[model samples]
Target: MRRAIYTGIEAFGSILEGNPKKNVIALPILQEVSDLPCDTGSELKDLQIEIEQKDLPVDLRFVEENWSEKSGKYEPTSEKIRDRAREARCWLKERPESEIVVVSHGGFLHFLTDDWEDGHKFEGIRQSHHL
Candidate 1:
């Protein structure tokens, strides 16, 4: 599959301070952002609950690999990040679309885009997660 990389976030915690409902300028290409988490504290779940209270159009869909209420990375220890990527690819392939926007955490993007690797063009992204 062909792909092009894009920039959006600075620090993971910054997303928490952001308001996706009225602050669409920060997030584009989609009215929704898939809260990319591997069961980690993306802080999006708490926000989701809060957003639901007000009834906003900014859709926040949590992918199974990236959401946890207990805390810590809530992902399966056995599941490699690539596995999630494969599943996502298959799922997207089924849905025909000319353009798709995938909103994810830095950790997920680091591994998925493999942009953190030396010589990678997107090495400009801040490396907050080691692995």
Candidate 2:
């Protein structure tokens, strides 16, 4: 999560440097991590602190449960994943931001982005959880 935030800041800082009118909003999905002891609530709080300390213009939106992990213990079927992805895509399309940066686990990244051509792209995403 930290890496993704840092990357987003670094990646977009320059492009948005001189544009005061532009806005950057972060919508971290409300995901459940079964592998981890706790959930992402604390992480989001910490992230909020970091953003405040930096005085970033990022507007932290509500926790989006739509993109959360699989509902059951077992892994979701491919069709289910696709359905979730489609639903996520629909939700995202309604957002006001012109550009959005998503930072999520490996299992959901491809599904969210619909970029299955390059499997290696998601190699760095954590493997502790799956969608």
Candidate 3:
């Protein structure tokens, strides 16, 4: 029963609830609806634990390979993300039934989606997926 209380609002969130109606997935840095970016390294660590506990067959696309610890953000020109998107596109063309979900920090998300909306501070971005 992992729980979190976001400080500013003094709000509480139950980290994980049992047997969500649909597929439940976590993208460490990429909390789809979170207004704030994830703290460094925590999302990755949490995902590792989730994957291990669930025995999920997730195909991680080398998110950590070129990441910089000091910079605390993905490379501005993310060749890897672009490359993976291309690869996934190619794969999807081969098999349309398959779906690919990318989980990443806001910094990386910016590179991937060209969406740098000032950390989505106000009127946060919304998506079809939730983590």
**lDDT of each structure?**
0.37, 0.53, 0.37
Candidate 1 lDDT at 75 equals: 36
Steric overlap count per candidate: 3, 0, 0
Candidate 1 has which clashing residue pairs, if any?
A: 37-66, 38-66, 39-74
Per residue, candidate 3 scores C-alpha lDDT tens digits across 67-106 of 3232333222244444434454454467543554443444
Alpha-carbon deviation at 111 in model 2, angstroms? 0.9
Clashes of 3: 0
- Taking the tens digit of each residue's C-alpha lDDT, what string does model 1 give over 1-131? 00111132222224524554322121111111122332224345554565467543343443232344322333322134545555556665675655555655544555545566544422322233233
Cα lDDT for residue 21, candidate 2: 64
Model 2 alpha-carbon miss at residue 95, Å? 2.9
Candidate 2, superposed: residue stretches over 4 Å from native: 18-21, 30-42, 64-84, 97-106, 118-131
Top candidate when judged by lDDT against the true structure: 2
Colliding pairs, model 2? none
Q: Which stretches of candidate 1 lie over 4 Å from their true place?
A: 1-39, 42-48, 60-66, 69-79, 118-131
